[model samples]
Target: MARATMDVMSSAPGDQAETPTTSASEREPTPAELAAQQGVPARGASHYAKGTSANMMRSMLVIVGIGLALFLVTARPNSVTPESVDVASAAQYRGGQAGQPFAYAEGLPDGWVATSVRYARSKGDVMVWNAGYTTPDAQYVSVQQAVDPGQDWVDTQTNQGRVIGRIETDDGTRWVQRDREGKVQRSLVHVPDDRTELTTLVTGTGSWEQLEEFAEHLTPAKVTKAGSSPSVSTSPAS
Candidate 1:
């Protein structure tokens, strides 16, 4: 029998004049049946699904991040910044004393020093003698501090530090300094027995080639013994 001439059936319809329609019971399925009927959704319904997938994912990530952050915050117990050191100039900070402290070198441009602070580091041979120079304008810091704000070499490097490569001038003198973010300003000195060394870390701003001219002037000196004091001066810059 042809389908056009028979009653509705899963298979081909047999020869019958009547076509069957689904009953209300069949049309309105049970909850399980309805669920099954909607199981593998149609492509159209899938797009409009009310799901919180994105929000759930974001929440999961935030939880995980909070867990990790908590661990990090609790693991160590110290300030990230360096300690406030007393100014210890080379002349004032002596190696031998009742309670000896570390000594640091202080370099100031002429007419830059308001008063020389003679103090000792609580720790090493390194001395830090801060020159109490007034800020030119209403500024509360040195021009260098305004221009280049660095607590020290390690602080600068450890913090938002920059790497300025070797810059050698035309003359024999070279200037090594920690740049402002990555610009040049100060002179860093390293000394050996027979020679003096200079290192300039310019952060990401400078290229090795850009500092090459300044690097040519530096003469690397080996580390000298602690007892002897060497003169700190600039040679003829290259």
Candidate 2:
């Protein structure tokens, strides 16, 4: 009771905070603070009361701000988003190379290699294009084509409208499924280059959360200038 009231009072604006109660002697405490007073004998209640009141007010403001920020982000999320580390378009990505451009990010070990991929929009709801290479073994085009099948496989696949992107590489499919335990899963993987793939299966998915997660891990190969190639970055632990 006191904790909830304290939360309400703290969340109220400055005017309300200062709007002294009808009986000015009444006060409430945080959930934790209220719990501590049941049996323990301590210093003056006034000692922490004022400080805690201030802290509560500060916390209220922080929480309100965070709520507003979350609302804004959730309400207006990006329609088409790309990741920073392994983006298909950004030239800064420094993975993948000549016949081995795709990097697999999943339940793999340290020995699992990663190459960059480049994706381009070629005039459809989903487009896949090339960026360049991070290694000499990276495939330049296969990585991008597998993820988005644009116009090719659209005619053959079922529920054609449900599919997205292009699939130019090996035998890869992006579809919805359920595990043996009856959990929901949405997955997509493409290895146009190396032909090996990685996937993400969201446990409980509703919106494009699964697709968003898949895009988050799908990286593109990095590209250098027309004449020069990108230098490899070494890991400290390696």
Candidate 3:
């Protein structure tokens, strides 16, 4: 009975040791244990994730700031209407000396605004004195004097407008009227009787009567000494 008891004690200790080894093999390792096995710190991965999140947030904020700045710049106010301009003063300033042989409008209707003036050479090196205006009714009108421009220049100025009729002014000055169908403008061209190197062209959206009225006011001054052409000056007219 003593020998059987000793054998039973030895076997019981061996069974208990084997049971613990089986349990340890079946159990899964924790994340910390797995990281330790791979020689990496578990807390390092968490810190890296937090840093990535912070970087993403900073990028988003930068994009939003740029969008806000663009919105503020685009929403700023701007002026739309053109300002008033003086034609005669601008013409004189642009090489239209008194007593010079240059074409100018003498008596425009009240409230008519001159918007721009230019003294330059056109095609064929013909010097041109031009002025743009806005009528009281908000229509466009322009007076151009081409020095010795031929029929081609007239065609170019009128945009190849068809010859409609003639306008006889009060001063016995005859103007050839041209109409451009399917276009926004018409023109009145006057070539002096003496075939002088000066052709006056008034063209725009104004009616024939308005254009004739404008043409009647044209008075070409005789310049003793034609000065050098001046640079173009443009301004908005309302």
Candidate 4:
């Protein structure tokens, strides 16, 4: 009986040891392990977080590009308006200081903006008066007056142009028009019969009609009761 019991116990232990036992390394692969083996990222919290960050970055860049496009479409910054300069005040100051019969435009219709004015001495001690204006049609026109000027000065002011023809004003006063090499500038010269008088010139890039209109409004400057105040001629120059 003792031998039988011992043999049974020994056999039971041998059977238990011989049966196949699963080790930690021999278990079935989990979902995450399967994904890693397949070269696929697991759908975890961290992975979803990275995907959301990438999406947000792309969305921000798209928004910024759209905003920039809208701004460019709305902003038209090419055509700039020229700032108007105060020609009257400058002309007044110059006339008062020069103490001569300075010429300036007066009683002009609207849209005539003076861009510049000056009364100063030029080469050879020649007293010069200049006033520039933007015409109603956005053309440039200027008045140039010099006292006892030489031929060289005349040539310089007229851009070394050749006398083409004559232009008559309302008062039958004749002006000599010069033709320049290019259409860049035109000149109407009023050469005083007496060399001692003021040689008035109307010149600019304006059309002949615009130049005539500017010349018609030319008047002699006068000092006001306030001595320094500038005054324009009541009537146009003859």
Candidate 5:
């Protein structure tokens, strides 16, 4: 029985271990295998191309938005206009009465609009009257009158201009012309033998001809009491 068992064991295969299997992480990948992987693109060229296309689209949208904003801002229209004023009525309300030693303008030409008028006590106890107007060409013109003012007052009014020449009006009144940088000033002094002296100045950004026209229309008047209400009898030019 022992001999039969030994013959059967010898006939069987020799005792050898099977080969061990390798894990996925420990194995190397081929180039074709990597190329077939999903969710990943090729390096450099394709990736930069997609990124550049997206950036260009965003930049174009921003440029279009800025252009639209500028057009809206510049094309808007103005909806309101400024109100006009009456100089004569304003002067009357500010103590311009008959027989007062003040200066005023009458028979102003067409297209001239008075914007302001004032009468106030100034330095050296002198009374000053001023009336501002907008000329036909939209330039600024003003008539300033002072009672017994100093030469310094005249200098200040003329912007320290030097006397250029003299102009004689139709009424035999002589006006002194002063040349200042960016302005023209014409002044006249009235010294009555029985009354106080008066100085009238026509100064403005208007042309010399416009200033002369303003000076020609000026007339001397007197201030009445304060708080006087006067009627305006003039109309604006068409």
Candidate 6:
């Protein structure tokens, strides 16, 4: 009986020593716990951050596009009018200085704005009077009065256009219409009277009808003589 008891005690001790036991800290961690320990963001948080960045970029692009559109709309060429210049005074003053009858535009309706005026000598030493205007429809037209201009001067002023046809105005003067293909239009007239030796040219990108209208408004201008308070005469071209 003592030997059986000793064997039982020895077996019980051996079983206790051989059996394995696990603690909470020694077990393998779950996926979620591993991710947390590795500092990985959650799926929901990652998606939210990406969505916010994309939305911000889209909003910035939309704002920039809207600003560009507004700028283009406000800066259109047709919406702006050029500053108006005084043709009558310039014609009178230049005519007085040059001792000639300079022509000026008169009785024009609203929206006809004179843009430029100058009196200068050409390449052939010919004195010329120039005036430019913008029509109501935003078309450009200019008048050049030169004393005995040569063919080269005419070609230069008319942009090397060829004579298309002739047109007679209310007065006895006749004008030739010249055009360059896809370029400019010109109306040219010669005043070879005993008193005046002038060649008048109307040129621009405007239509023929608009050019004719501008030519009809040209009026002969008289100037005050140098050092004399002489009176000037004004006449209509119609």
Q: Which candidate is the best by TM-score?
A: 6
lDDT of 3 at 85: 54
- Better by TM-score, candidate 3 or 1: 3
Tens digit per residue, CA lDDT, model 2, 1-238: 7667766666445554533255534656655666577755544656436777777888789999999999988877543232213333233333232223333333322322333433334334533333222222211111233343533443222222233443222224444422222433222333233224322222122224433333444443444443354443322110
Compose the digit string of candidate 4's lDDT tens values, residues 81-106: 54566555656666666655667888
**Taking the candidates one at a time, how many backbone clashes does each contain?**
30, 38, 4, 0, 4, 0
Which RMSD does model 1 reach against the true structure?
Answer: 19.5
Poorest stretch of ten by lDDT in candidate 5: 186-195
Tens digits of per-residue lDDT for model 5, 77-189: 43222245666555555544423555567788887877666666666776777777878788778887765587788787778878777887777777888877564444443
lDDT of 6 by residue, 149-204 (tens): 77788888787888888887777667888887676565565546542567888888
Cα misplacement distance, residue 225 of candidate 5 (Å): 4.5
Q: How close is candidate 1 to the true structure, as a TM-score?
A: 0.25
- Give the residue spans of candidate 6 off by over 4 A: 1-53, 56-63, 66-70, 73-78, 191-196, 227-238
RMSD values for the candidates in order, in angstroms, are 19.5, 22.8, 17.4, 17.3, 17.8, 17.2
* Collision count of model 6: 0
| Ten contiguous residues minimizing lDDT sum, candidate 2 | 133-142
Q: Residue 191 in candidate 6 has what lDDT?
A: 46
Task: Find the 10 residues in a row with the least total lDDT in model 1.
Answer: 138-147
What's the candidate order when arranged by decreasing lDDT? 4, 6, 3, 5, 2, 1
Clashing pairs in 3: 99-223, 100-223, 101-223, 148-197
Q: Score every model by TM-score.
A: 0.25, 0.20, 0.57, 0.60, 0.57, 0.66
Model 2 bad stretches (over 4 Å):
1-180, 191-219, 224-238
Candidate 3 structure quality by residue, lDDT tens digits, 61-128: 99999999998888664323335555555555554453335555777878676666676777777677
* lDDT (tens digit, per residue) of candidate 1 on 1-238: 6665553444545755445766787676666666668895334343325566886787789999999999889875642322222333232223222122222223433322232233233123333222222222211121111112223543443233344543345654443444454433333332222322112221222233433322342222222344454433211101
